[model samples]
Target: MWNHTEVTKKLSIKFPIIQAGMAGGITTPELVAAVSNAGGLGMLGAGYMTPEQLESDIQKIIKLTSKPFGVNLFVPENPVVIQEEIERANQLLEPIRQRLGIKKKSHLPQINTSVFDEQIQIVLKYEVPVCSFTFGIPPRETIHQLKKNGIVTIGTATTVKEAIMNEEAGMDMVVVQGSEAGGHRGSFAEPFDDSMIGTMALIPQVADHVSIPIIAAGGIMDGRGVFAALILGAEAVQMGTAFVTCVESGANELHKKAILNGTEEQTVITSAFSGKPARGLKNEFIVKMKEHEDSLPAYPIQNMLTQDIRSEAAKQKKSEWMSLWCGQNPRLSKHLHAAELIEMITNQIEEIINKFHLIKETERLI
Candidate 1:
């Protein structure tokens, strides 16, 4: 069957569809368990979770389902803390903060370089079936440790060079995130702008260069996308925006409604929210900060700086100020149960296969 592939065999899942482990509460235990229970690999977006929170969620997911699931982590990046940049970024954000009634300036964030190690230990302790990383590949020793424990390791890449780097570092699979993908850009080896290859182009080129399995992401929302990814040499596809609208997703109702009502032209890639370039709905926060993006603090710093504004915006039901992350194919999004979405995808694939067979028989008769 088309669903059975190297990814399915390696991950021990029934289908090659892997739910993107979106961070910031989108991948709730209930959502993860539901997808895994339905035969797709469900993942917990544990990028921002504390070690304690990770362990608790793992326990909760275990109670919800016996099927395999995965956790996605942000491979730590320690950028130099530039005090001037923080003050400048804050100066730009002050107006929005005041509008949201956020009185206190967000404290200078303490960068914890040890969080990744602690997270690795939690995965090891629980023997989580799969562990994936974004931002960049983890240390070789970390990959070796996961493999030694019989846990599968996956990495994200935006360019073919990055994909090869993941394979060289011993990753079992690499998710080739196209520029159209939602959330953060995973380009590490070069500038993200130069690595913005679309899904159709990136998948085949990376497949030729890397021996490990490839998981195609970005702008893929249905079985048609899954079918095309397989044809392009990807063994599976990872979907994030598709799942963000699922009934069980932990995304705020406003976020979900925005995506459902959004058009393809509405999404834009901006670093205004997290200091990392991510695609999402263009809004007041993004537009107002466009001029200041070049000076913003890197990643965790800017991400920490904006925490209060985002949280307050969500609480106040202000979608314009929130980080409304979405892919390029928002028009294809549907509000369905996770299981129903999976089922619809599988059924759609089956219909396409049948139509292809019918065409072949017609050609034979002619």
Candidate 2:
């Protein structure tokens, strides 16, 4: 039997499941709306979009579903770029660029101006029901403003200390992203390497430490994983890899095929594609960039530099060159509609619960 929890009640969602906001153009309005319409909380990945794009997508999602949805923003990082490091990375990339038939000087791509404040303004203008953030905690003033506008706030954390920090900052809930999760690690308080806590270990510890509801995220691809997370004290499970195979997913055909055919052992946590460490399928691009990993420029810089190459690769359907971000268990991802996927997961959880009850009853009879 499904049970309503603090997360479900607070979010006004029928199910205690949230489709992970897999940013970088992967979380399209269609996917978000489908998930919301299916009774799960769907979130728009606003982390990579311009304020204008975010506003348009927000409006689109609203048009499609009356259910409450959330937007996730990346906490900006303005790291000082060591010119020498960038230069070395460029030299390392020159050979690959030549291999890909591109001849260009090693120079940083101009970054699009960050519209964080404007994006926040858009969220408030729409009265978006929820806002979640990763990479780092939002400024207290920002949090305060959102709360004043009646937006339910969530913060992503990679450690127990970070969860406590989120609670202290007055967030409505916390998403504890474990080490096995795809995409970027949400570690900000310390070096990310040291913060690699797994879901099984992290959820219970975070639950014990924070007063707010805990949402578990990582290698959770099925209902069994959701059942396990709830038992470990999570109020809900946030899944990204599983949703990548959904019919409404924004992943390319190659991305979907690669994910379905891939395995946990095929993934590696690398900063080659983007300057920050994110888990993705190991391809020739990732393999060649390994040597220059330490010298790559910080995010937004290296990420911008490689944008054209990635785009061209995608145009050519070169999976090897695509980011292909995925969690540990890619094989478990199913190709289903978002609504159908939710129903399948719900049934799986119900079956698990029923089996447990039957086992207990039989034990009592004995």
Candidate 3:
């Protein structure tokens, strides 16, 4: 079997793997605690959450496991750079507003990035052991504070340039999220379309460029995939879609079923959910939204418009109307508790490594 090294140990995790903090409340305390209790790092997705909500979740996670779990923050990165998108979203949502039982059009909520300071304070107050960010490099002062407080920091990177920038920016590690990863694309580089590199190519390339350890995230699911990533020089592996389907996960039943039922081709990257690109199963909502691509507003605005509709759709088991995120190797998703799943994966990794050794021994005799 392949020798497991220190990833969580360096990061203070019991396992080398970390569960990606899927946003929009998909990452729950139980889900995180289960993983942490099982040895892997479980991260609370605090992207859209308010400070109070974030605190409550942190408390809940603490209740579940005293072992270290991380929290993911979405750094402010909006590409729209236009105020017209707000008006555009209202007009586009005119029909949705009518059906949502609202009589008059209401202006979109204040679009502001004022929450970062407050969010950071809460993390510091709680003294969280690990905090990771997406979108771009977090402030150097904040990075210094985290390091000073003995907190391990992680930055998500989609390209070599981003990885190098992260290393320079003083991040402790970089999550090399390939294009095939579920949910949002952590593209901090120009020309987002060109940032779609797969894990097999991106991991080694990023590892080679940066002196920091790389966490392979994207299509990794089973033990064979984990072993493959370790052999590629990845210090650890992070799996998002696979854990999203776990019994302990907070994903709605429809969303969970959608992930477990999905095939590689069933998923596609679309900005229909939010103005930003994310990978989800192609459904009626996406196909219909494609017809009005020009009218779609920028993120947060587009994200808010579909919020209620997505919620209602989930209650009705309408997976087509919701964002169903999954990775390319989603077929590896299994129906098991988070802890049991980890045990199974470890066993599989051992078996795969043993088979390789057996092959090598036979070849030597020949």
Q: Provide TM-scores for the models.
A: 0.97, 0.95, 0.92
The residue-level lDDT of candidate 2 at 336 comes to 93
Per-residue C-alpha lDDT of model 2 across residues 1-366, encoded as one tens digit per residue: 244888999999999889988887778899999999999999999988889899999999999999999999988878787788777777776776676776685557555545777889999999999999988888899999999999999999999999999999999999999999988878989888988999999999999999999999999988899889999999988999999889998888788888899998999999988799999888999998898788799996788778767877888787788898889999898899999999998888878978876443445677
Which candidate's TM-score is highest?
1
Candidate 3 has what TM-score?
0.92
- lDDT, residue 290, model 1: 95
- Identify the leading candidate in terms of lDDT: 1
lDDT of 2 at 101: 72
Residue 101 error, candidate 2, Å: 3.1
Instruction: Give the poorly placed runs of model 3, Cα more than 4 Å off.
Output: 1-3, 78-83, 94-105, 358-366
Flag regions of model 1 displaced more than 4 Å: 358-366
Q: TM-score ranking from best to worst?
A: 1, 2, 3
Residue-by-residue lDDT tens digits, candidate 1, 191-296: 9889999999999999899999999999899999998999999999999999999999999999999999989999998999999999999999999999889999
Q: In angstroms, how far off is 103's CA in candidate 3?
A: 6.0
